[model samples]
Target: MKLLKLVPDDTNIDFMKWRKIAFGISLALMIASVVLVGVRGLNFGVDFVGGQMIRVTFTQTAEAPVAKLRDTVGALGYGSPSIQRFGAPNEVSIRMRLPKEAEGQTGAAATMTNAIVGSIQKDYPGARVDGVDSVSGKVSDELFQKGTIALLAAMVAIAIYIWVRFEWQFGVGGLAALAHDVTLTFGFFALTQLEFDLNIIAALLTIIGYSLNDTIVVYDRIRENLKKYRKMEIGELINLSINETLSRTVMTSLTMVIVLVAMLLLGPETIFGFTAAMTLGIVVGTYSSIYWGAPILVWLKVGPDSFVPVGDKPGAPGRDREGYTR
Candidate 1:
């Protein structure tokens, strides 16, 4: 579990220059992503957009791959099918927009299922259709709304928790960083034209939790340092806090990125979007912790006075490295 060693001494690293560069890059990417989202939009899955999903398993390993199956399914008078491997090589899932021509028919689902199975059989001999699932447009819409609300609820809860844990300023800065990460991740999806599905929503929530954890660690260090060095310039104090926490921050993020990268490369295609979003968040969250959250503390003019003990002079309780209450 110890993938990284914690640095014992705080190294004074000047991250302001890197912060500027990071800001410029993230801003440009975010704007481009927004534009892509507006113009091209995300490739929504059947769960978000109403469609028919058929799960088919081959009797043996599929001689014809999912791409070929998609092509064959498209030739059967259906729209381009979204074909992807399911649990195993023998299992594949296909989703297609519901045919308008079958709107009112009682056996539309059955008819669509049979047609897809027939198409698979024709293209790849010995293919067997396991099951078909259909969701009406209304149901999909409801799920989308529910997922959105849940995300909003989680953000609110996190903000309140941070506010109670530290101060309103810390809460505000942490929330801003959280929003930065989430928006940038959304921008990536929009820019990349990746599929937006229920799993994508889950990935986003995971990002929120992770980004908050990063922000909290930095904020906690800043709060502790603020009480230790009361008269130092706010900017310098913030910079020093970033340096103090930099080692831990980088080590944690780097480890997470390594795991996510492996999953991105070797994991199933179904989670490609999810893992990609997480990978992006891992990088963004780390940057925001320093550049986004730390700068906010500076701009807020936070100093040792913000959390100084009422009965003692500033730095009076500053103990030695032993951490005793002086």
Candidate 2:
């Protein structure tokens, strides 16, 4: 439901002021994210970092305290284990990076599990070793390669689609805007050391889709305005196009942000990474659609005369209700 209107009318708004403010804000956030990325690296999950996941379940609700369980696992010589409550207080999961000595053993998975299980049993005899899984370095490498390929393929496909649907300049601007959003998101993730896993990849793709969709809306308006505002300067046309579509952009983005915020509050932790990334993307996407996307069209020499005619194109419509001919 529409809670409240976020943006007012598009008519007679200060285009230059808003676009400049948007650009400044986007650049500032992106730069801050980059600095953070440089200072703190991303926390790659077991899927990328290569580790073991140990799950334990107690027979009864009052079996053992979480602290006791962690202490038991810690004494096993597992280095820096991440302990978290899984399904319930009685269920706990711990993930730890295996020692370098167990790197390439043929049955490294079973060996690691057995070692951890033996240690856990020594402390808590009643705790059940629910499951143990090992992720090889080779597997992480494979996943890294596959995730890269998927992201590149998506970017290429989107560029091609936009180019085919609109002009070459439109496609280029759309891609630039997409890159801005992705890089900013990555910067934020890296700075925070948020676990980069399959879920993060999913979030990146969702951002790509969201950013591209925003670009398309603004581009559609630019295309329409080019035909209507004949003799208008390129910057003026772009600014006007953005202003014309501003209402729709804010409305659409606000709705999605509302849903995403709900998920952020009530969603499972499994989806927390994805939701957070998308939430940032939605904010950046909205800004880029008007600032980054439209500004690029101006830089590319796209002008009103490209779509409209001074007199008439070689073969196109004459004049219309707007007095602009295609």
- Using lDDT as the measure, the top candidate is 1
TM-scores, one per candidate: 0.80, 0.76
How well does candidate 1 match the true structure in TM-score terms?
0.80
Q: Which regions of candidate 2 fall more than 4 Å away from where they truly are?
A: 1-4, 18-40, 55-94, 99-127, 262-270, 308-325
Error of 1 at 43 (Å): 2.0
Q: Tens digits of per-residue lDDT for model 1 on 147-212?
A: 989888988899889888877788788887887888888788877778788888998899899889
- Per-residue error for 181 in candidate 1, Å, reads 1.0
lDDT per residue (tens digit) for residues 11-87 in model 2: 65656556667777878877887777777867777778799888888765554466666666677675546666778
As a TM-score, model 2 comes out at 0.76
Give the lowest summed-lDDT range of ten residues in model 1: 317-326
lDDT of each: 0.79, 0.77
